[model samples]
Target: MTIHRIVCAANRKRFTGQIVLGIRHWDLFMSEALDSEGDPVDQGFVDNRGNFLLRIEAWKVAEAAGQIIRRVGGDDTNGGTLYSENLY
Candidate 1:
């Protein structure tokens, strides 16, 4: 397992975390939530479009899963708000 760095190109913010392996699955665990211009952010934040940025590596995991759905027991207006960085 590797600790990866995720950068939101839209916001220029960064997060440090690892891809956690589960029972035949994988998940993201953000050990360090955010770094906004060198300042630490305690909580999760989204973009103006209400989406989180997923880097290439994370996108690979999601792509391998066939589809990326919201986490279990997570707030569901329908699903999660995550988008691939490559898309933008």
Candidate 2:
């Protein structure tokens, strides 16, 4: 079983709506699933008016039968603020 650890980061945009901070990063990743050659995969995720819905958050997702999944970071609502806040 190949466990994929998806680590995502978030930042406040100057002009935009509200995001849970966690789902935003995942949404970006889903829309841009890349391979080794550095190409576009067309994640096929909808914008939904800027509402990011997480698989785990929704308690439902598509995955293999025995896949070890884990969401390291993303949502910072309940004291889950990002690990690092310095990215330049």
State TM-scores per candidate. Answer: 0.23, 0.18
- lDDT of residue 55 for candidate 1: 37
Q: lDDT at 84 for candidate 2?
A: 20
lDDT winner among the candidates? 1
lDDT for model 2 comes to 0.30
79 Cα displacement, candidate 2 (Å): 24
Regions more than 4 Å wrong, model 1: 1-54, 68-88
lDDT agreement with native, every candidate:
0.32, 0.30
Error of 1 at 86 (Å): 11
Off by over 4 Å in 2: 1-17, 20-51, 54-57, 62-67, 70-88
Model 1 per-residue lDDT tens digits across residues 1-88: 4323323322223354322211111113232322224533222222334344333334443434443444433223234333432222
> Clashes in model 2: which pairs?
22-74, 22-75
List model 2 lDDT by residue over 1-88, tens digit each. Answer: 4432223333333234223243344455533432244332211111223433243322221122222244445334443222222111
Worst 10 residues of 1 by lDDT: 18-27
